[model samples]
Target: MSPIKNPTTFFAYIRRAPFGGRLTQGQIDGVNAILDAWEYFKLTDHRWLANILAQVFHETGGRILPVRETFASTDKAAIANLEKAWKAGKLSSVKTPYWREGWFGRGQIQITHKANYLKLGQRLGVDLVKNPAKTLDPVIGARIAIVGMAEGLFTGKKLGDFFSHNTDDPVGARAIVNGSNKAKLIATYHKAFLDAIEAARGAVDAADALPEAAIADDVKPAESSTVMSLLGGTVGTAGMSALLGVNNPWGFGIAALVLLLGAGAGYMFLSGRWSVNRIKGHA
Candidate 1:
């Protein structure tokens, strides 16, 4: 819920000196937002998310713009059109040079090869050839990448796969992005994945706990009884009654009893008894 407190922790896993001594505030915010979204989508496996982020970091130099160059005035209109089409769900077929040969690969994760783009785009509902710049936008690019990772684009690919073309010596990919420390780059990827996993786990636990809380807060016990009676009366008729009788009558009764107990337990759990203890424990 709170922001990550230590900035160094944020970069702890990076294998090299970040291209800059520190990422700009906008870059940090963008990265955090991307990480948060990955968690939200339940794609936060440390191995996956970290590798993806690391690749992006390696490609973009931790900046969102494909390179330092600003979009020319002529290109501005095209960029705007692309943004509009992206928002409106039109322009499904478009590809930009940037997506093909610019920073990183092209499209989400800067996937450069047209073949790879076509494959990955199918899962993201994009035509990689038609709308490549969509990968340039922080939100869309990251989302597409998360989906690509989910679809196993990165699986079995070595780190060199992402950086070979960028550096003179293919192995220099790690050294270039990581500066003097290749391990830091690997660690950064590892941490990214860990962050994604932890965030997703917290989200899932909260989600699992929510239905009980919502029912406890929004529905009266009487409302539940009314619904149960309606279902039981209709479904518990002759055939059902006979089935229940033939199967274990005791089993049916025990199931009902258990359901009631579980509901009560859920209500209690939502009533904030443990919440107080949780807060206290944290304190």
Candidate 2:
């Protein structure tokens, strides 16, 4: 069972801002997928889960599912429109114009750039390089968003930095994925998500209920036995990288670079690179 005890209350709380007071089936499914990934990983931190939920709320523009850049409906359309934007110089900040190369952002985390694709693909054990569209798969997309931030793959900033037992900074937690573009705004969503998460019943460590001898030596105490059972009894360590690198499109660092390049969208990468943080608030 999910750590979230009261999903009914959780959805009701989110409807206010991120969901804009409504939800489509796709949005609900997206949220469920993320929650499942949470359990699959045997995560028990409510605040961390809330922060992740808040980011997905913002990054997907509330659609909840993995999204294409410019909110395009399909891959061809996303690429076509990105090409147009690049040609018209609307995407001036793109130092490499990665979109033109079919590296346009996709997934809940909106990962862009071929380097990011290759690196994350290696970490997640998916062929995002040869078949980038795999990032759009619900399971894979959820994993990218969660693991990217949880492990600090996007900006080298992990969730614990901002939300441990002694601290809670949703505004700062924004760095876990991107920078501070909508830090305060996401913070609000964070509070709301926290409330809903708190309402949910907490999960007991399924490992505790098992006979000591039945437990596998390789099984970590942190994960519940149920998670292991769901996985048919195994978890790989590939996606748990401690490496911290910057690949976001919406961040100020890249935006400043774009500004130097004349109204650049490199902010596209940081703010969104980490949302598509590719070119947020623009084409």
Candidate 3:
């Protein structure tokens, strides 16, 4: 089963953005781009997907598309602070294009500074140092955001640091991108997205299991203890209680079918066989 059941269903879930605004077509496209990149980049873990999307949504403030950093127009105080740091020699005062030429904070994840841009550009085979405007492109921005976050490029706080099957700290996940800034807010979005994605995942798995279910329906077991033996005496006793309730043959048959399904699902769940092997099959 794929991480997403259907794009429509996924979009429907995404419409519940925290800020309570409608998503534009471009924003939807950007989301699709992000999902595609996740698959392409092999970050298909549902937990990771939920956390990543939450961070992205929080960063963009319900905007569908990845946007360039607007600190120049919106926050002169920050730029002045950076300038002050530069003057004090606490940070490099290199007057590159990104510093003076409006190339600063151009990616969805907002990779700032000329040196960082040059490094990321070299890694991705794009000349961000020369054409820093490319970071504003949604596709490029998605790639940068996806790869950067997953790999812990943002202040060495990788996605793996806070996400795993056994443990998930959505608020702490903010550390993966920006060191506890808006951690709780992003965590709220994370839980919402996680619920949506898990629902979609269950839907996809149920859909995929239909054929197997049909096959099970076709095979009616004999009047023997084989199923009971396989299911163990305790489980078989409980199943028999349900199976023996019906007086009519048709009702009995339906009850038996239900037991068979329950047994199959229980076995799969206990043996850890039900989940799709996404890592093995998908890149």
Candidate 4:
């Protein structure tokens, strides 16, 4: 079981870590969805959660949330080049029509193409084909990111391949999604998130160990039912913003921009824009 089970603590840790700056209500719901998915998938390691959160935080532009698919460029030539790049990479063969119009790269992991969506939809028992945009649904997106990465459904690199009790290679874990495109940057974010998560876990554990009488009536711990209820109910969920589309096939180029949030988060941490001290203030 993860020590950071309480959604409040889990999200607070995220907000404190690097680029995670006050996640929006929808993003909070996304984090909750990930928590539910984590249990459903039976992922046991805290390290895996930390690494996953780091990747997601980067993938969602440091909001520590889920977002609609983004585009790289709207220029005609750039779109043409993007199509060629996808073909060369053998990622898709549908050509320009379906590539340009079909729903592709809709999830947080940027699950691409009609075939892939149908396949994932079958696995999860969700009707992604009829409602392809549901892939961007926070709950569904959480499941995709967690299940896909853990099972190596993406790039043939599973989370277990890089993270375990004996070995921890966050940079190498980038292969679980893309093949080390910004492995070092994601790794840096992973470290900050890991530390923050551990701290939150420790706080929860310590609170649990305390006697009921020791805690003041008004001073509720983050894991307390009161805290959880307050967190879940106070900030109501909202629809995520619409997808920022490009003129070309929604593939790696624009997807790469979203993924670059990993490096952006690192920059936030280094620049002191988001820090442990600041997080405490919010807490």
Positional deviation of residue 211's Cα in model 2 after best superposition, in angstroms: 38
lDDT of each: 0.45, 0.70, 0.65, 0.62
Point out where model 3 deviates above 4 Å: 19-21, 71-98, 202-283
lDDT of 2 by residue, 32-76 (tens): 889988887777778888899889889998777899988999888
- Least accurate 10 contiguous residues by lDDT in model 1: 208-217
Between prediction 3 and prediction 4, which has the larger lDDT? 3
Off by over 4 Å in 2: 202-283
User: Tell me, what's the RMSD of every candidate?
Assistant: 17.6, 24.5, 17.8, 16.8
Model 3 per-residue lDDT tens digits across residues 1-283: 2487644345545555453434454565667777877777776678788887888887766664666554333334445655666778776545543445444565567888877788778767899888877887888888888888888776788888787777778888898888889999888888877766765564443332221111111223222232333334434767876654454434544666677788889999889988665566665
- Writing each residue's lDDT as its tens digit, candidate 1 over 87-191 gives 676645545444224322443355555666676667667765676556666666776656654544644334434323452233222432333445455555545
Evaluated against the true structure, the overall lDDT of model 2 is 0.70
Error of 3 at 91 (Å): 14
Candidate 4 weakest lDDT stretch, 10 residues: 238-247
Which numbered prediction scores highest in lDDT against the true structure? 2
Task: Report how far off residue 8 is in candidate 2 (Å).
Answer: 2.2
Off by over 4 Å in 4: 5-9, 71-98, 203-283
Query: Residue-wise lDDT of candidate 4 within 71-106, one digit each (tens)?
Result: 442334434655667768754644553446545466
lDDT of 1 at 99: 29
* Candidate 3: worst-modelled 10 consecutive residues by lDDT: 209-218
Clashing pairs in 3: 27-64
